[model samples]
Every structure is written in structure tokens, then in C-alpha cells.
Target: MAPYQFIERPTPFNSKGGSTLPIFAVTPAHIETGTIDPIALDWAKKAGYKAESGSLLLIPTEEGHLGGALFGLGTNPSEQPYITGKLARTLPAGDWHIETAPLTANRLSLGFGLGSYRFDRYKSEKSSAPTLMIPRDADGADIKRQLAGVFLARDLINTPTNDMGPNELEAAFRGLAAHYKAEINVVSGDDLRQNFPLVHTVGRASADAPRLLELRWGKKGHRKITLVGKGVCFDTGGLDIKPASSMLLMKKDMGGAANVMGLALMIMDAKLKVDLRVIIPVVENSISANAFRPGDIYRSRKGLTVQIDNTDAEGRLILADALAYADEDAPDLLIDMATLTGAARVALGPDLPPFFTDDVELAQDLTEASLETDDPLWRLPLYGGYEKDIRAKFADITNAPAGGMAGAITAALFLKRFVSNTTSWAHFDIYGWAPSERPHSPGGGEAQAIRALYHHIRQSVR
Candidate 1:
């Protein structure tokens, strides 16, 4: 599918000979007066604008060309900005500009540009949706950079698992590296056994060989940021196995890898001043004679022995090795993401992911970013008390506990053992799929924490 065209300038008066739509911000007070002041007042009056949030009004222009649109945002002194994602599907195809508002030009541009995304990859019949044009004064480069990352993540996640296997994921990473002139290295098959034993064990059963994909960019001597993602391309629970119903959406098991790549795209596109390193262990946990069995013990890259209490708990095994490798460099910051546990969803639901971190200030920054971006995340405690669940009698730790309580916390504890060197580390346990369609999000592979993480890193690190 062709990528959507995004521009970042002041609102254009003409959009390829199509009608130009002016979007105005409205309030309850303005609705009573039947006028939006700066735009057309009479049209708003006739439309019965009540200034209720998300209300949109379209008025015909004096010329035969398409007219403008007025969106209602309830009046509150500190009301959040960019609450109009639903506009993506509602707005008619044409150029649009914010005519009246106090929002920062950057925020306004980003809000509209992001709202325009649609996953039309597999649509047999093409969509005739009209493209929205940016204003002349908007920051085009930044808008394009952000949208590119978002669309990249959406496209990768939207593709079904049958086509997006472990090998295919590696190809996507290499493709991105080639596009940006970044260096790429991949360790697979026998090489993985020698170097990334845990990663190999988790992915050995599938016909596709498991691999560790690495991409490095930027010059030496810069502050380093290492990203680790659990790339279980398709998990069928290995020998432990999942019921057919439970495994239906297993294709999205690699959501963590998709998100990291999305963030990487944003950082590189914007030329953020940091040496970025991305490590993903791409594997498929399918059932076969070669698949690792429950109760099997494997030595990890960190030299800690891990007992596989349940083959279904395979995400952490791959991440354990990748996290160990990431910690070896002791980067300035280490972040790992995965669709790890259902317990997280039980605690915070699907919309809000739980993040684990030891740094108070970093947690505060992430919280603020989540509020600002409307991408909510709740901080989950590392809870030192839960550490005992991961300890193994014979090995350093066990991948899963025989008892099922605190599944998410135990999983986090398992990954925590591998991340000792980094001073500030954050782990996000995300449910990558959206069960139902909403305004900005369609029901497929959703980018759970991408926006919040992007904002936090850009503000704090860069």
C-alpha cells in the first residue's frame, strides 16, 4: 500500500483544485451566540452549535469550492489539546487549517496529521479518501517524521502473522536500516545457539530460524540509548501450547519489536542527538519435536541458568537474553517492551499499559507525557516482595511459576534479573491488539505506548 502524504506548513488555501476546509475551535458560550467569531458565525448558528466536545459543523463557502469545518471542544481552563482524533474518519477529504485556537502550531499540526492515518493495506477495493493538506507555517519536517514512525508501526502490526514471521520481521528491520544508511547485523541458526542460547531455544521449533537483529546508527561518543524488544513472531505456546481460541491472535506476539522500530524511525528521522541501538530477538514458538520442553534448563547470555517451568512463558526467555546483551553496554537508558502478560490487562485493561521502573523522576516524566499525548500508561511497582516467585531451586531462576498468581509481576521479575547494569530502565507490558475499532485506532495491531514513549524520550533525553 502507498504511504499517506503528510505536509507541515500553514493551512493551504487550495488543495489540488479541491475545496479548502477551515477548522474552528468552538465552546458552549460561542454556541449560545451562534457564532465562532473568526470564521462564519451565521453557519454555526444555523447548525445549532452547542459547543459540546467533538461536535463538528461544515458550512458551504462563498465560492463553489468546499467550505470549512468547526469542531466543538468544551470550555475548561485547562482542557487538554488534540481531542479530535475522531476527525480522521469524519472530515471530508480536502485541505484543512485551524482557524481559531491558542494551541501551539506544532501541537495543532501533529494532532491533525496523526488523525489522518488509516490502515488500508489489505482493502480489496481501494479507498477514495481525500488527503488533508498542512498549513504554510506548520513544521513540515517534524510532522512527517512523527507520522512516518506511526505509519511504520501500524503497517507492520496490521499485516497478519502468516506473512509476518520471524524471518519477515528481520527483513523489515534490514529494510529500515538500508533506507537510513544504518549498520545492520543478524545472528541466526547455529550462530544463535553459540551466542544467544535462550533466544535460540525459544524459537528452535519453527521452520524459520530464530535470530537476534541489531541496528546501530549515529557517531561514537554520544549518550547511548539501547532498546530491547521481545520479537516472538508467532507463539503457539511451544509444547505447553495454547487453546485454539486463545492462540487466534498470536501473530501480534512481536508487538514489542514493532513499537521499538516505530520509535527508532522517529528518532532517526528527526536526527535526535543520541547513539541508538536496537536489539530484537525474532523467534516463532511453535510446537514440534525440537521445541524446548517444560522443566528444561538453559543457560542465558548473562550466565544465569533459567528453568522453563512452562513453555508457554516464552516471551521472557527471548527478552532475557536480549536484555542481558543490552546491559553489557550499560547504555544511558534501557527500555524493553513486550505483549508479555494478560495479568497486566486484568489490572489496567487494554487501553492503558503498565510500565515498570526504579527511577522516580523518569516515572514522573513518563506519566506527564502520557497525559499530554492522550496515550495513558500506569506505573506498576517492581515490588521486591514478588522476587521469590522467579527463584528456581536448581537454577538462578524459573521462567514461570507452577502457581498462576501475579503472572505479570513474576514476568517482570524474570526480566529484571537481566538488567542490572543500566541505571534507568523501563519495561512496558502491552496488549498490542485493539479488540474494537475506535476513532483514531482501527481494531488491528495498535501502537500501545509509542506516542507516550516518543514524547518522554524526546523531551527528557534529547
Candidate 2:
């Protein structure tokens, strides 16, 4: 929560509002046609501004008063949808408007608000960025709601493991449920072991007991939608352990839970006509005397025995139970998201997450939504050939395969075994953390696929 403010139906220039500036986004074409303001043109020439990407210039009148400013869009302005986000940090702490551009007011304002985000929760002091006063035509409220969800996810993800353990994660989940007036049920510790053995096995070592968190909202008879998230709050790799470098960002192991919370926020805020259920198995994969060993075998909630070939692959174990639970009711749509495998990151890198789903229509809708929202997702085949890879002689299945080939696919295949009843179920292997900065996103905890998924849901609801 910075000093930024979004005003609806903005008023024109007036003496009452001090130091308000007008921003004109310019492309190479605009420069060639002599369409820009004469004052700004003169300033650009004097300042050697080429209207290249990220270029900004302010014009001064004869009386030394601020005239207007120019922003560069390079070859295609639409490509950099959130380029205007820079205006919030670049311009002085005051009101500014996009005078002309190929972009919509909603996009411009949304970018500004998103760019202004800072996870200074632990910081001593926070800086005040310039406020972006949006136009009346812009969908300010909707954008605000979406960003709120993203920020909520980011805040939860960024918190260190010490403070964001299983109990704290349940608190965050409960907070969201309370805000939306949803009913919440939590089965924790020993009860989890009895009902969700896979979830309990993965989290048995941690002092913060493992919990199966469920929140339900909307009418019972409405189109049913169930969301399952892998809430590994902090993964220390259990008995197998991890290298120091690999453990650094393990706080984001619960990214799947964070993302689901974000998507749930978007759904509940919009009052979408659907019964929504969120299932998160909040746990921390820590090491101790009680930690589940890699070779340990345990019976899962779905009545299938699992041999833990790798304790590091515990995310899928917890999700297996949650997914099985979700499948029992056979909802209209079921989605499970998790930072399940580094193989996914190796294949698609950090920004482009991979999703697995058998439904052709669902995949097509999600693909279009990805393009529409600029939240990219690649469809990876759930090859039945790899199904044998997860099969184990000792148990019904193994959490990890022996060959270590096609890890993402094998993980998806393993999860697929538990989801027999759901008509439409998709699995998302998300990085959950942005490796670097983007136009609208900072480099911390990133909300992946939710925007695109929201678009897909919107279409489905309509």
C-alpha cells in the first residue's frame, strides 16, 4: 500500500490540482508524421530523444512551466502493454495521464498500479511513488481486485519460512475465507495422517503440523469448481536434503497455494456464478529424526501405497491426496497448481509455466486466455508412455522414478492416477517466483496462470 491513488472519471487540467502532467506516448510513426506536440518535439530534439523504448522527455514552456511529457514505445506500442507502469516511478509524485496511445486506459492504469508495488513488509520505511489517476472508461475496480489477489499471493510467498509455516499459511487461508464469507475446515496433525496420509508423511518432521485446509463458497447447486494447491510452505528436502543454493528460495515452495488463494480472490470478488472449493495441504518439508525417508513406503488417502524414491518430490505426494479428495465429488472443473518439479523450469524456464490437461476445449480456452492476458503457459503432453515410469513393484506407485528422465511428465503421470472421477482436471507446474523484473511484475513472488485462468473461468461462467 503505497501513496498511489486511482481516481475515476478524471477531470481535465485545472489550477486546483497542482503539478498535474500529461503524458503522450509516441512511436516512430508518430515522429515521422509530425503529430506530437510542438513543445515536446522541440524538447525531444534538444534532449536527443529518439522515442526509443523506455525513453521519456518533459517539455518546459517559455515561462519555465511544465508543458507535457513524451514516452517511447519503440516499433510496436501494443507489445509493451505495461510500459506506462514506468510512469509511476519515473514521474514526480503527482497526477499524470496518458494523452494518446494505442493502449487502453484500463491497461495503462493497471500497469501503473502494478508497477508501484513493493514488498516492503519488513522494511523500516516505504517510499511514496507517484499516484496514477485513471480515466472513467477504465475498469479500475476489476484491475484493483486482480492486483490485490496478486499482491496477496506475493506477500504470502515472500515471507520467510520461519513466519510462513503450515500454521501461518492456514491463518492466511482463513483470513481470505473470512474476507469472502466462505466456510473453512482444517484437518491437521494426526487427523491428517489418518485422512490424508500422503500429506502427513511429507510434513511429519516439521514442528508446525501438516493440515488439509478447505474453503467453500457460493451455492451448492451452482457449477462446481474445485482448486487444489500444493502448500509446501518451506521445503528443506526432508531426509534427502538439498544443497545450500537450492534451499535459498524454498520459502516459495508453497507457490501453488499462494496462486490458488489469488485465483480464489478473483473469483469471489467478481461474485462469479459458481460453487468454489479451495483445498490446500499446508505443510513444511523439514529434516529431523521423524522426517520421512526417501525409501519409506506409506499408504495414501486414496488407498494406494506410495514408495518415496525422493523426499524432495513431496509436493506431488501432498497434492495426490488433495487431488483424490477433490475427485471424489467429481466437480465440473478441477485445477491443481504446484512448484512440483525443477524439470519444468529447466524445460520452459521461469516465466513460461507448463500446464497439463486432457480436455481439448479447456486447453484451447486457457491458451487463448494466456495470449490475451500476456501470462504465457505451454501445454505439455501427458504421455501415457511415461505412465510405466511411475509404476513401482514394491508399491502401487513411486513418488519419483529411478531413471530421472522426463521428471515433469512422470510427476504429471503420477498425479493423473489419483484423478479418475473429475471430468475436467488440469495440472500446472509453475515456478511461482519471477527470476527477473518485467513490465508489470517485479522480481519476487510472481502470480502465474491465474490471470489467464480467470479469463478462462469468465468465459466458462458466461
Candidate 3:
């Protein structure tokens, strides 16, 4: 897909007349009051603009050329933030500019730019969509940084499993490393067994060798921030195999990895003050004679023995090794994301992801960040009492419990065992896929907790 074109205006108040399409804002009550601009009101009235929020109006100027559109934002000016995204989609296929509006410069710029995202990689005729020009007063650098990360995540998730396996994921990480001049280290095949045994065990069955990809950036003296993501490129449920119906959309099992990379890109691009470490355990959970069985036991990097209660719970297995490796450094902050359990979706649905952390202060910060960014997350208990369910008579712990009463909590608890050294650690069991399309979010590989996390990390390290 071609790179997104973002236009920067010289000044917020100066209206550059290069755009072919113009969008005018209107309110429902404005039509009744007749107090709006006479020229705009007349044009709107002629175009049958009722001024219902989210409704679009297109008018033809006196010239033969096509006129601009009229968008309805709600009565409250503060609600205008929601309109930019809607405008991105409602506008005609031509260059557009916000000539006049009540929106703040930053909100107007970022919302419109983000909403304009569309994955057209496989499309025969690409979308010649109009570009949105940012006002001079707007934070163009920040807006572009955020959008770049988001588009990167969407592109990765939209890709099929055949083209985005373990090796492909490593290549993608390597590209990011080369771009940022970060040091990249990958332990795969035999090295994985020697260093990250649990990661090797789960991915040993697939043709693509399972590996742990680590990228280190920033100065060593800065505060350490570690990110762990489960990169199950494709999940066939291993020996416990998923049915054909369940296997559909399995390509999205790597959403966690995509999201972490998205957040990493944002941090690196912004040059946040922190020592960053990103660990992704790339694996393909496929069926084979060598596939780990339910009764199999594997020793983790931290030397904890984990008994496999279910082959389908391979995500936590790979994450176990990555988390152990991350904990070894004793980072100031640690976060791991995975589509680990179905119970999280059952509890919070697809829109809201559930996060678990033992630190109250960290939890509060994340909750506030979620509310501020409109990317909300619900806090689920680590529930130390539930640890008994994961106890293995022969091993230190079991990957899964017998009864699936608290699947999400148990999984979080399982990961918590591998993160004892970090002062502040959080785990997010994200669904990663949007079940349906919304105003700004599409149905495919959606990014969960990225905005909130970015905000939280920025504030925490500062």
C-alpha cells in the first residue's frame, strides 16, 4: 500500500485555497435559528441539509466544478472531536481542507487523519482518497507518529498467515530495528530450546521454527520499559485442534504482536526518555507428531516447570519464556499482551480488553489513560486464590486448569508467576479483532490498549 499523504498548513487561521473539496460544519439547531452564516445557510438550505449530526451535505457551486460538503456536528462544541473521524469517511474522493471549524487544532488534525486509514493492499484499483491538510497550529509531528503506528498494525494484521509466519514476523521486526538503528537479537530453533525452552516446546510442531525476537533501543542508563507480545502467527489449536469454524480468522492470533510493535514504533518515533526492550515470541501452533501433548511438561527460562493442561493454551506458554527473559533485566515497568483466553471476551466483550496488575497505582494510571484516550480497558483481578487451580502435582505450575471457571484470571495469574522482579507489571488479554465496524475502527485486526498504553507509559516514565 502507498504511504498516507498528510498535508501541513502554514497557519491554523490561514485558509490555503488548494483543496478541491471543502467541509463546512453545521448543527441541528442552527437550521431552526437561521443565525448561521447567510452564504453557508443558503447553500445548505438549497442542498437539503437538515443539520443532523454525522449527516453529510454536498453542494454544487455556481461554477461547473463540484462544490464542498457540509457535515453536522452535535450542538455541543466539545463533541466536535467525534466529527473529524466521520468527516474523513463522508467526504468525496478529492483533496479536502477544514476552512472553518470550532474544533481544536490537535483534535481536528489527528482525528481526521486517523479516520482516513484504509487497508487497500489487495485492492486492484487503489483508493484515490482525498488527503486531509493539518492546520499550522496543529501538532503535525505527533499526529503523523500516532497514525503511522496504527497503520503499521492494521497492515500487519490484515496480512494472511502464509505471508506472515514466524520468519516473516522476525523480518518485520528486523526492518523496525534497522529503521531505528536498534540492536536486534533472535534465538530460534535449537537456541530457543537452550534459552527459551517453553517457547521452543509450543512451536516445535510447526514448519516455521519458533523463535524469540528481541529488540533493544535507547540508552542503558535510562528507565527500563519492557514489552512482551504473543506472536502466534497462526493457531490451529495444536493437538487439541480447533474446528474449521473456529479456525477461520486464526491469522489474527498475532494481534498482540502487532499491537506491541505499534506501540514500540510510537515510542521510538517520539524518542521517549526510556530504555525500551521489545520481546516477541513468534510461533505457529500447528498439528504434527511432535506437537506437545496435554500431559507434556516443559521447563521455562526462569527454571519453573510448566505442565501443559491444554495444547490450545500455547500463547501463555510462549509468553512464559518471553516474560521470564524480560523479568531477568528487572525493568522499571513490564507489560505483556496476548489473546490468551476466550473468557475475557465473554466478560468484557470485543470492545473492552481486560487488564491485570498487582500495583494499585499503576492500575489507576492505566484506567485514567484509557478514559482520556477513549480506548478503555477493564481491570480484572489477578486473584492469588485462583493460583491453586493451576498447581501441578508433578510440576511447579500448569499451563491451564481443569475447570474453565476463571480462564482469564488464571491465565493472568500464570503470567504473573514469571514476572516477579519487575516493580510494575501489567498483562492485557486482548481480543485484538473488532467484531464489527465503528466510526474510526474497522472490523479487521484492531489495535487494543495502544493509545491508552502510550499515554500511560509517557506519563509514568516522565
Candidate 4:
């Protein structure tokens, strides 16, 4: 499938022929200080343009031709850093350049590119996007690389389960690995049963066999950064089953995998001097006569028996095995992203996912990066008091705890049990779906936390 059409890097702006339109990112203060053109300022007073956040006004020349535009930054531009995203959808299709802004060029350009994304792979008609001449001060390649990663993730998650099943998802994974020239391997069928028993169990009932997909890149002796993602392609909630409304968006169950792929792309594209590894447990949680039951106990890859208290909780099951495998390597940094629980959304909502980590420095770095990248994330405590909730009476542990209190934390603790070897490890419980349209992001399968992770990882390694 073709990639999403994003903002372009245009030739350097020259005012000789008036070919390009200038866009001023103005705050309320700028408007009051008469910082804008006198003609545009006079028009603004007549038109009642207060320069509110995300508001746009087109400036016309004396000849009645489109001359320029003003994008409002409001009084507190920092409060809405990516407010320029509105321009991507509101601007007329034309060559434009940012003449002035309160924020960095990278921030404005990335926001525009992000808002320009459209998943029209299945549409009959294509949409046209306005072009932006990347600012001279911006890192054009960096912006493009991040945009590609985000778009790749959104595309994968937005695909319907019929076209995004285990097989198709693996193909996409392989395609990415091939593009980056990374070594790839898969363990499936009977092999998966022995190597990743929990993964095989969760994915066994689907028509497509479940598998463990692994990719390795960069030199072996460098700072090792291993990523694990939950890849339940289409979750029917297994034998437990979900209400029709709940299952409608289950196709995004594999959003965790999509996000990790995005982060991996950014890491490889920048050629960060660090050893990178990705482990994804790809599966479709379906129901059948032979489907793993709520009472069934299966041995995990870590040799721990897990009782299926609720088959609906399958993401953490597959992630348990993958995390164990990743932990065995004892990478310098181990990170796992999963759309594992609705409780995460309950706690922090879909926009700000909660992450759990024991490492103080990792938490601080991720917090700083989250703010810097505008990829919001909140750190939740791995409370030891809740450890008893995951304990099983008949087995080593239970996949789902009763009462449903602090569900997200318990799920993280369950996965944390298998990650004993890794010193710096963090788990993100992401909703992965945007409930409604927001500035710079459309409502669909969304990329959460990866940008922050990418920023933190890149800075730490460098």
C-alpha cells in the first residue's frame, strides 16, 4: 500500500516572483503590538480576528489575489505547541512557508506533517494536502523520518482485521525489516508451542497460526535496546467474548506492535548507534471448540504456569512469553507497549497512556522526552501491594485478577514477573485508538508513546 501523503520539503523561499505564500504564527500579543502587516492588521480589526488558538485568516493583496495567511497562537502558545496543525487541514492547496513562529521550526513542521496524514488506502477518491516548504532552521530529514514512522503505525492499526490478520501483519513486519536490512526470524506452529507456549496458546484457535516475530539490527556489542509489542491482530475476547460495541474496535488490539514498529523505524532511520531488537507475538484471539478456556493453565516461555482466569485478557498472555524471551537477553533497556487493558484508559484516558517502571532515571528521562516530543505519557506506580491480585490459587499466576480494581497495574505486574533479568524496564498500557479527532491527529488507530520513547532512547544512547 502507498504511504500517507505528508508535508513536503520545498525549495528555499525567494520573494522574487511571489510564488510562495507566507504564514505568520502570531500570538494575541503580536496582534496587539502591530507586529503583522498594516493592511492585514486593519483587516483583522474589521473582521474580528482575535488570533485565538488554531484560528486562521487569509490575507489578500491589493489585486484581490491570495498573498499570505495568519495562524493564531493565542496568548499562551506554549499551552498548545502544535496549534499550527490546524493549518494542514484549513490552508488552501498552495505552496506556503512559515515566516515567523514562537516555537521551533521542527515542532511546527512535524505538527503539520502529522495533521496531513490520511488513511485512504481503501478509498476510491484521494484527498489533496497543502504543501509546506520546510523551514530552513528545521531538520527536514528528521521530520520526514518521524512522519514516516507515525504514518506506518497509523496505517497498520487502521487496517481492518480481515486484511490485518496474523499473516498480513507478519508480512508488514518482514517488509519493514527488509527495508532496514535487519535480520528477521519467525517461530510458528509446533515450534512456537515449545518456544513461546503462551503465544501459541492464545493464537492457536485462529485460522492463522500464531508466531513470534523477531528482528535484530545494529552491532551486538553496542548499548542494547530491546522492544516487545503485543500483537493480538483481532481480539474477539476469546471464549469469554465481548459485547458487540466492545468488539467493534478490537482490530486495533495489535496497536502495541504497530507503535513499536514505528519506534523501530525511527531508530533505524537515524542509524542510532545502539543494538536494536524487536519481538512481537502475533496472534488472533478467536474462539473455537479447542480454544484455550478460562480455566486452562498453560506453561509460559519463562516456565511459569499461568491460569486463564479470563480468556478476554489475552494480550498480556502473549506479551508474557515475548517479554520473557526479550528479558533473557538482558538488554540495557527493555520496553514493552501493549493495548492490554481498558483500565488504563479509565485511569488516564486514551490520550495519555500510563507507563510503569522501576528505574528512576528511565522514568525521568521518559517524562522529559514526553513533554519535549508532545507525545504525552504518565508514569504509574508498580505498587507491590497489588501483587497479590495476580496470584493464582491453583497455578503460578492468573492472567486476570478478580474485582477489576487497578486492572492496568496488575497487568503490568503480571508481565513484570517475567522480566526479572532486565534492570531498566518499562511497560506502557496504551489505549492506541483516538476516540475523536484532535489537533494534528485524526480519530482512528493512533500511535502512542513511541515518539517519546524514540526521543528518550536516542538522547540516552547519544
| Whole-model Cα lDDT of every candidate shown, in order | 0.79, 0.84, 0.82, 0.88
Model 2: runs farther than 4 Å from truth? 1-19, 61-67
lDDT of 1 by residue, 181-235 (tens): 8899999987988679999999888899999999999777877888888899888
**lDDT (Cα, tens digit) per residue for candidate 2, span 1-462:** 222111122221123233567788888777777688777777777887778876778777789977778888788877888887676667665566677776787777777776766777678997756665566688767887778777777877888877787877888888889988999999999888788999888888889899999999999888899999999989888888899999999999999999999999999999999999999998889888888997789998899999989899999999999999999999999999999998998999998999999998888989999998877899999999888899887999999898878999999999998999987999999999988877677679988999889878877888
lDDT of 1: 0.79
Candidate 2: give its CA RMSD in angstroms. 3.7
Q: In what order do the candidates fall by lDDT, top score first?
A: 4, 2, 3, 1
- Candidate 1, residue 334: Cα displacement in angstroms equals 0.8
Off by over 4 Å in 1: 1-19, 35-39, 61-65, 75-80, 135-137
The residue ranges of model 4 lying beyond 4 angstroms of the native Cα positions read 1-18
- Model 3 TM: 0.93
Residue 351 in candidate 2, Cα distance off native in Å: 0.5
Off by over 4 Å in 3: 1-20, 75-80
- In model 1, the Cα lDDT at residue 201 comes to 95
**In model 3, how large is the Cα lDDT of residue 154?**
71
- Pairs in steric clash, model 1: 9-135, 9-136, 9-138, 10-135, 10-136, 10-137, 11-135, 22-68
Number of clashes recorded per candidate: 8, 0, 0, 0
C-alpha TM-score for every candidate: 0.91, 0.94, 0.93, 0.95
